[model samples]
Target chain A: AQSVTQLDSQVPVFEEAPVELRCNYSSSVSVYLFWYVQYPNQGLQLLLKYLSGSTLVKGINGFEAEFNKSQTSFHLRKPSVHISDTAEYFCAVSEWHSGAGSYQLTFGKGTKLSVIP
Target chain B: DAGVTQSPTHLIKTRGQQVTLRCSPKSGHDTVSWYQQALGQGPQFIFQYYEEEERQRGNFPDRFSGHQFPNYSSELNVNALLLGDSALYLCASSLRYYEQYFGPGTRLTVT
Candidate 1:
């Protein structure tokens, strides 16, 4: 089984400010990491995903995340954020479930990012 | 292409009643999965359907059932609904062995 932990429950940043939302995962085997954003009353949208590639992965809306295997972390970062960036972010981990013969995503509780002017 | 879509944007039901939610997979997608999202929480996987059969399931009760059609559409049926069942039901579509795309979800409120 795999579990994802989002260190912060909420992050508040001023417009044009940089922000980082930390995420950590625990899994026995290889994993895929992803970041998703959800606006109020809407479904989650994929921000970025790390299936297999370089350590750093860039995503939409100027967001990027680094897959640090040693630390078991995949933290999302953005150089600057706009007010519209305010939303709930989720960190997820997907791994092959041998018992089910399929991949399932385990998500973090979520981090609410609020951008202020 | 249209993304995964779910029907009945919102539904209200009473305890002990049964409810069914529908989903249409994205174009070119043959796999559909269902998830439950409670207020202020992340979505939890309920099950996945592929090739007109249930290929995977999560930790849910028997009261939760599903079916997949040849067209790759799907439905989630919940029996004996309880107040605790009030939540958002999300549908996701994906290609086998790939990432999933989600729908806006159907809000189900059980009174």
Candidate 2:
């Protein structure tokens, strides 16, 4: 019964500009967080994950996200964006299920990032 | 190594028809999960398979079922499909207690 909320549905950033995508989750138990990127007509590629370590998690393509437990937020940030970074990004949460002995991801509505040239 | 893969990149079906989607998990992975992604929305988990059995399932109805083979490949079958069933079906694979990798997905279009 975990859920994720992405504050923004669309984000537009100019080439070489910094951008951030906000995500928040609600869960009764501890959880893992992740960010994934999807190009047009392609499957999702894992950007980064927060299992249980540093709050700042770095990912591919110079993207990073910080896990804020108190705020229940895991916001993705990129110092600079490229035209190729224009894609849909998703924030997901995973929680262990004792009955199944596995974990399932619950994703947000998604934030479409558009990098303008 | 090959990541997760799904069959029939796209399929078109009429309402009330049945559809079957296939998936091959990544190498060395023993678990597979199916998800449904509607247009402009995130993917929703359908179910998970491990050791050739269903381990977890989401809020989907019994009309949605799945099977896993000995080779760790999986199949998702939806009976009496409705227009709302038209969406991208994604298959994800993972090692025990590990992160999951995704497939390109099978687009099911119901007209």
Candidate 3:
């Protein structure tokens, strides 16, 4: 089983200011990490994913995240924020089940980022 | 190409009523997964379908069921619904073991 924890419930930041959202996960097996952003009344949009090879992954909209295996953390960061960046951000972990021949995603409760203008 | 699509953008049901939500996968995708997102929470996986068969299921009860047709379109059916069943129903499609694309989602309200 796998679970994710998003340390912050809500983060308020001014426009053009840097921001970070913390995430941690626990799993019995190897996993993949992902970040998704959700605008109000919409489904999630994948910002980036960390399958393997790199500890630092960059994504669309100037977003990036680093995977720290020792700490079990994958925190999202952006150097600057725009008002449009206001949205609910989710951190998720995916584990493959050989028995089921599939993968399942476990998500955190989500962090609402409010970028003030 | 068209992304994932879901029907009846919003729905309202009574505690004992049943609801069926629909989804169409993105072009060229063969797998469909269903998730339920409650207010102020992340999405919880319900089940996944491939080749018209249920390939995997989550912790949800039997009251939650699904079907995938030959065209890869799918439906999520909830029987004997409760107030807690109200949520945003999300449908995601992808190739096996690939990145999944999500739909706009159907907002279900159980009153």
Candidate 4:
């Protein structure tokens, strides 16, 4: 089993400021990491995923996340944010194989990102 | 092609009543998974269906069950619903060993 922890429940940042949302996962086996964003009343959209590759992964809306194997972390960062970037972000993790005979993702509670003007 | 689609964007049900939500997967997708999202929380895995059989289940009780059709559509049925069931129910579609694509979800209100 794998679990995701997002340290920040809420993040408030000014427009055009850089921001980082921290995430950590616990899994003894190989894992896949993902970041998703949700606006009010909308379904989740995959921002980016770390299957296997370099530590840094770029996503839409100028967002990027770096996977740290040693730290068991995948933190999302952006040089600048727009007001429209305000939304809830979730960090997710999954084992390469689940005993239940399926590949399922376990998610963090969520972090609310509020962009202040 | 259309993405995953869920029916009855909004639903209201009284306690002890039953409710069924439907989902149509994205084209070319063969697996459908269900999740429950409470207010201010991330979505929780409910179950998954593949090839018209229940391929996986979560920690939820038996009151929460689902079915998958041969066409790869799915339905989540809740028996004797409770007020705690009020939340957003999301349906996601995926291929074998592929990342999931989620639908807008059905907002179920158990009054």
Q: Which stretches of candidate 4 lie over 4 Å from their true place?
A: none
For candidate 4, lDDT tens digit of each residue in A54-74?
A: 989999999999999999999
- Per-structure clash totals for the candidates: 0, 0, 0, 0
Clashing pairs in 3: none
Instruction: List iRMS for all predictions.
Output: 0.9, 0.7, 0.6, 1.0
Q: Each prediction's DockQ?
A: 0.81, 0.91, 0.91, 0.82
lDDT of 3 by residue, B52-81 (tens): 999999999999999999999999999999
List lDDT for all candidates, in order: 0.94, 0.96, 0.96, 0.93
Kindly report which residue stretches of model 2 are placed more than 4 angstroms away from their true locations once superposed. Answer: none
- What local lDDT does model 4 show for residue B12? 98
lDDT preference between candidates 1 and 4, better one: 1
The count of residue-pair clashes in candidate 1 stands at 0
Superposition error at B35 for model 3 (Å) = 0.5
Weakest ten-residue segment in model 2 chain B by summed lDDT: B92-101
Flag clash pairs in model 2. Answer: none
On a 0 to 100 scale, what is the lDDT of residue B33 in model 3? Answer: 97
Quote the lDDT for A5 in model 4. 94
TM-scores for every predicted model: 0.98, 0.98, 0.98, 0.98
